[model samples]
Each structure stands twice: as structure tokens, then as C-alpha cells.
Target: MVAKSVTIDFEFDWGSRIKSDYAITHVTEKLLQVFKKYNSKGTFFISTETLPNSEKYIKMIKNAGHEIASHGHNHTLDYDVKSKMDLYNQIEKSKKLLEDIMGEKVIGFRTPAFKRSRYTDEVLEELGFIYDSSTTKSKMRNRYKPMQYANSKKLIYVSISTIRDRFPSGIKWMNLFGTKLTGKKPYIIYAHPFDFLSIKDILKLYDKNKIPIHVLLFYTARIGSMLNTLANCIENSQTIKNIILQKNEK
Candidate 1:
């Protein structure tokens, strides 16, 4: 089995409040094309709210054999959550929506923007999630570990790889620069749908939505073209679920 896991966060334009689906509507084929060319299967961490606009594509990803994991119902930030109930609802609602549409028990989760409270994992375990891929830095061997919560339940923590050691080396970095800068082996790489958006569209959306300069800096390089190169470099790959199963076997 390959030591790497491929993941894509199915969300809208880079954390903006825009209710757009251009990436799902326009760029998934490109992402899938790269995966197919490289004989890889990935896990998709989907934000359930995007379903109203991107359900067909979500189904397409499922039909293509990628695992469906929850990214939360609305991709809300941790600071914005009013209470633990709100956070629980965000995760539970997404899990249910994904299960209903994909016709499978959704068992994995990755918080939106990789930001979560200390209680997030506990909540995930309580919600019956088998694993979470919300962290970007992992210190253990292979960057995978069984985390025990207050309730004595264990949830596996799967990490997203970094670029040039960048803490938040998200998909856009891969889209623009490839994965040459990724971390050590057993890499768990992640990208967003918007990472595959065309440069012209990216510019238009950035201009229209006034995407912050900090977010804009990540897009200085040409986007929408490095996916094939990125995939070509990703060796035999599997969904995060399979990766975890294989690890448990070991």
C-alpha cells in the first residue's frame, strides 16, 4: 500500500462567504482527470451546505470511489460557534447529509480551514466519527495516531501535509507549485475545489468578492494547471479511510 493519502476539501471560494459553486461546477473534472491519470483514489471532505448547489458533483466524486467525509454543515469557524451544541450540529448535520446523499456511513471529518477547538475531536468521537483529518502538523510516526477523548472513545488523527514546511500548505499551493515541497513520506495531502479554479475566474472572483490580500498572496502564481503534475507525483494512493484501515492492520 502507498504511504500517502490524497484529500480534497469540497468547498467554495477560499473561505469567503460567497455562495458560489464555480469550482465544483467547473473544476472537479480537472481534478478527477488528474487522479485517474495517476491511478489514485482520494477522500473528499465536503461542506454539506454546498450540496444545494453542488450535489451532482458530490455524487460524481462518490461514484468515482473517493471517500466522503464531513467538513461541517456550513463551514463555520470555531470562534463563531455559539456553543458546543452548535458545533455538534455543524458536524452532525454534515455527516447526515453526506450519508444520505452518498448512501454510506460517513465516518471521517476534517474541520473547515483546519481550525477547531480542543473539544472538536471529542465531539467527533461522540458523533461516531471513526477519524478526523483536521490537523496539519502531526508528530507521531506516519503522522497518524489514535486519540482518546474524555469519553474513552478513540478517534484517529490524520494530518494534511505541508509545503516548504508551511503550516497551512493547502491545495492552492499544490495547484500553483505542485507537491515537490510536501513533507516526509506517509503524506496526507489536501486541496480545495477552488484551488483548481482557472486563473481568469480566480481573478474575477477575487475582484468581485474582495478576497483579502493575505488570501490573495496564495494565488500570485498561476493556478489551475499543476494538478496533473501533482498527481503524477502522488504514488499509489487510497482514501483516508483505507489508509487508516491499512494502518490498523499493521
Candidate 2:
């Protein structure tokens, strides 16, 4: 059977507005268990600002045979607003911090909210990054511009696949089935730890948060079954590094 590459990307970020009761550790543990059960691996894009506290979790992901990548210092949208040097420092510092913790070179990056400055690609190339998974082809989102950056010698921009709703959700049946039906090989799916969280956990923070009710349900309900379906649908699973490496050999 031909092995079709499927990349599962996860974003890890926390800020002041984040709920105190929502524990990343708890959410991460659940995701790890799910991936393990499916015999799948994922690339976790971690925010460097959450370091020290996230050290153990990062270690846990690494030891689990998964890949780690940079998600910037904080969940800042500064990539579009900050100065070029400031942006460089932000990317450089986060990459260094993550490398220090992982004890390995960090080669992948996904911008906060998929917002990339004009200098985003230049900075990534300068930092020796191999690939970026920040762009989305979906046209529904107004803030995100539609553009495709073909893979080159310096870096590859892996566009995030969108579902009917233009969001990458494991539970989105149409997103998975439609992609397969359309013969879109090497599918990439991006998710957040909170997607696997329980409704009870989310309700605790719902009072103060304005998160939509259906959005919460879409992620929390039948998530396990949805993930399992995804695992079985894809012929092979791979990290972004492996994908690029294979492409380079071709």
C-alpha cells in the first residue's frame, strides 16, 4: 500500500486572559493518550513564554517520540505590528529557548493565529528553519490573506487544510472525508489541546469567556471517535521534518 503522509500539528499557548482553571498539563496528557492509542505522532508548536512551567510537558512530548517546534515567545500578534529587528528577536529567542529545552534543533514554526509579517519568511530562513505551517488556503477568514508559497531550498510553507467551516478540526467529518475524496494527499491537520478537553472543563471558564457554544460542542463532543476515524483514514503519519526530507530525496 502506498503510504500517504498525514501531519498532525498542535499549538500550545497561554496568556494572561487564559483561564486559571484550564490546565495545559491536563489537556496535553489527554492528547498524548489519544495519539498513543492511534499509534500516531504529532508536531507540537509550543509558545516559549509558557516555558519553565511547560518544561515537563515539552519533555513528555519529546519522550513520546513526537516532534517539537516553536510557536513564538508569547501568543502575540506582533509579527504583523512589530519592527523587523523586534520580530527577528522574537523568533530567534523562542527558537533558542525551545532548542535549549528539547536539546535539539527546532526547525518548524507556526505563527500565532496564522498571522505572518512581511518579513516572516525572511526571518524563518535566517533562523535556519526548514518549514513553516502557518498559512491557510481558506478564503472565508477576512484577516488571513490567501497565498501559496511553494517549497524551495530555504524553507517550505505547509498550508493548513481547512474544513467546510474554514477551521481545522478533527471532529469535522467533511474536512477529513472531503480531502480524501478530492485526492489531496499528504493532508495536514492542525489542532489545539483544548479540542480534546471535556465540556465540564470548558464550562468552568465559559462564564467569563465568550466562546461560542457550538464551537465548544464541536471540539468536545465525540472527539475520540473523530480522531480514531482520522487515524484510520490516513495511510501514514509523519512530522513536517520527515515530510520535507522525503520530498528532498525525490
lDDT of 1 by residue, 1-250 (tens): 4477778888876753677777788889888887887888988889888877778888888888888888898866552243778888888888888888877799998877666565786678789998877766533323232232223248777767766665434555555545654565567877777766667787788788877777666665655455654565556778988878887898
Cα RMSD (angstroms) for every candidate in the order listed: 4.2, 3.7
State how far residue 29 of model 1 sits from its true place (Å). 1.4
What would the per-residue lDDT of candidate 2 be over residues 1-250, giving only the tens digit for each residue? Answer: 3323344334432232363425466677866776777676767787777767778888998899888888888676656777779878988999999888878899998888677777788888889998887776765557665543333467777766555545443335433444442223356666556544555666765665756677666556554454455545443556677777777899
Q: What value of lDDT does candidate 1 attain over all alpha carbons?
A: 0.72
Runs of candidate 2 exceeding 4 Å displacement: 1-23, 141-143, 148-153, 164-185, 208-235
- Score every model by TM-score: 0.84, 0.80
Report lDDT (CA) for all predictions.
Answer: 0.72, 0.65
Best by TM-score: 1
By summed lDDT, which 10 consecutive residues of candidate 1 come out lowest?
143-152
Residue 75, model 2: Cα distance from true site in angstroms: 0.8
Model 2: lDDT of residue 129: 91
